[model samples]
Target: MGIVLNQSLKNTIITYIGFGIGGISTIFLFPYILGKTFYGLSNYILSCANVIMPLFAIGMQNTLVKFYSQCKTDEEESRFLSFTVLFPLLLSVPLILIGLLFFDDIAYFLTKKNAIVKDFIWLIPFIGLCMAYFEIFYAWARVHMHSVFGNFIKEVGLRFVSLLGLLAIYFKWITIVEFIYFTAVIYFLAFLVTMLYAFRIKKPVFQFVIPSNVKEILIYTFYIILSGSVANLLLDGDKIMLNQYMAIGNIAFYSVATYIALVISVPSRAMHQIVYPITAKLMHNNQHDELNDLYKKTSINLQIVGGFVMLCIFVNIEQLYEMIPKEYSGGILVVFMIGISKYFDLILGNNNAIIFNTKYYRAVLFLGVLLVLLTVGLNMIFIPIYGILGSAFATLLSITLYSLAKLMFVVKRLHLYPFTAQTLYSIALTIVLFLLFYFWQFPFHPIIAIGLKSILVTISYVYLNYKLVISKEINQVIDNVLKKLKIG
Candidate 1:
């Protein structure tokens, strides 16, 4: 728990800093500098790359995390690492060949609704391949319990570089076309840096022979491929589908709102970097009691952090939208729909780590397949009628359904739950904070109003959570901070 707290807190701060830069780029700079069309085009390209990344990696990222800790000796670890490292290239080679063989057909299919996408179609696979290896090496780093550095690169370095690229466009130092191409360069550079860092963390000892548990490793990787693809599809499918159904510019508008909502999930993302490997180790050791305690603690701590962010976003959404261009403001509803759904997703703690690491993961993969179909079906039915809002609705429905299913499976199969009295208390407090400050907008500029309201809500929320002791882990951190400042 001490290590979890230290690392999670560090990761949380880093993730928020990244989100801060990303917020400027997404909410203000991109829309103002590039206009909605180019902004959408840029985001659409990245979204396509993200959707296919899991396939290119062939689930090696998760396979490494799940099995690395179970190896008995350095020799066994070397064999496992060697195979996982090369497995993705085996899958990606055929994919690359096929992509080239059917290049024109694939390009035509993608650009039918939005011809602007035609020029950048080739970059998708290139960027996806880069992202896949980045995660593969990131997992290699995580298995050694060295996640903070990799996390900084993923969370901060990428966004910071992209900010420079966006500023280049603003200063007319580069054309939007150049900016788009440069974005791929950014991903490739980040990938190379992460790979180097991975080797630095644990110099790879390549033993290409099959591991003793090759059969189990292969089976788990196969199931993980399905599960990982399903997760990415659910997360990124909306933006991709929007390009298909509406004008490309609508994706820009939707991306703004989605990014705002995604800020609420930062804690989960930060914590999961450390928690995933830890959960795998715990499960491998069959430490059920500690695992159960971790489940509850993670759920509460994430709920505390995510709930505070969600409340701030939901309460201040109207004022926040005032800063953005009017054309993009329609996503206010999109923010709420997606924001609440993400909160639900967050409170599940390390539910994903639990499911993906356990044997029952195969069953969850089945559920993931169904939810992917449901998400697509919902988008198909809703988008034509509702446009981007409909896309948000489909995401909300799919994510909620998926979160509920994962929660149930973990409880039924593993006899573990992430909820307790503190869970409900946190929910109630979140609602109260929203109702209290949401309507209390200041009679000032949007920025000033947001600043004051955020302070009030944050102070009130933190004070109450501390008094009620909603999370002992968080309370401990608070106490430590107070002691360091000599204010307790």
Candidate 2:
């Protein structure tokens, strides 16, 4: 718990800083400097890359996390690490070759609705390959329990470099077309940096020998590929569908609004970096009681933190749209729909870790594939009629349904639950705060109004959670901060 708190706090700060840079880029620079068409084109390229990333990496990222702790000796660990790095090439090479052999057909199909995507079609797999390897290396770091440096590179370094690229466009140093190419280079650089950092943590012994658990590892990796694809599809599939059904520019609007809503999930992202590997270790050790305790704590703590973020976003969503261009304002509904779904996910704590690390992962994978189909079906039905709003609706419904299924499987199969009395209290608190502050706004600039309202919300939310002691871990965190300030 101490290490989780310590690193999660650092990761949270780093993630927020990254999201801050990304917010500036997505909310301000991309919209104003590049305009919506180019903005959408860039995001669409990345989204496509994300959607296929799992296939390229072949699930080595998650496989490393799940299986690393089982290695009994340095020799075995090195062999496992070597497999994680090299096995992806087996699939990636063939996939790349296929992409080359069918490049023309693929390009034509992708560009049918939006020809702007035609020229950059090649970058999709190139970037996807880069993204896949980046996660593999990142998982390399996480398995060693050295997640902070890798997290910084993932969260802050990439966005910061991309910010400079955006500025290059602003200064007329690069054309938008060049910036698009630069984006591919940026992902490659991120992979390079993380790989180096991971090597520094534990210099790879590079044993190519297959481990005794090779069969088990292969099976897990296979299922994880589908599972990871399902997750990424749910996250970015809406944008891809938007590219197909709506104007490429609509993705730009969806990107901005979703980015704002995405801030609510930062805590989960930050915590999961460390928590995932920890959960893996716990399950590997067969520490059921301890695992269940972690489940409850993580659930309540994230609920409190994520709830605060959601409250701020919901109350200040209107002003947030005011800060962006009016053309992008239609995504206000997109924000709430996406935000609520993400909040539901956040409260589930380490539910994903529990499922992916368990033997019943195949069952959950089956559910995930079905839900991915459901998401695509919903988008097909709704996108033509409702536009980006429809895509958001599709995402909200799919993610919520998928989350509930995962939650139920974990509880029924494993006899573990993430909810407790504190869960109910936290939910009630979030609702109360939202109703109280949402209608009220400061008569000032949007920035100032958001600042004041956020302060009011934070103070009220923190004070109540502290008083009620909704989570002993959270309360202790508050105590430590107050003690450091000498104000407790």
lDDT of 1: 0.92
lDDT of each: 0.92, 0.93
Q: For residues 1-488, what per-residue lDDT tens digits would candidate 2 score against the true structure?
A: 99999999999999999999998898889999889999999999999999999999999999999988888898888899999998897778888998999999988888888998998899999999999999999999988788899889989999999999999988999998999999999999999999998899889987678888889999998999999999999999999988888889999999998999999999999999999999998999999999999999899999999999999999999988898989998999999999999999999999999999999999989899999999999999999999999999999999999999999999999999899998999999999999999999778999999999999999999999999999998888778888989963
TM-scores of the models, in the order given: 0.98, 0.99
Look at candidate 2 and tell me the lDDT of residue 30.
92
List RMSD in Å for every model shown: 1.1, 1.1
Off by over 4 Å in 2: none
Worst 10 residues of 1 by lDDT: 205-214
Off by over 4 Å in 1: none
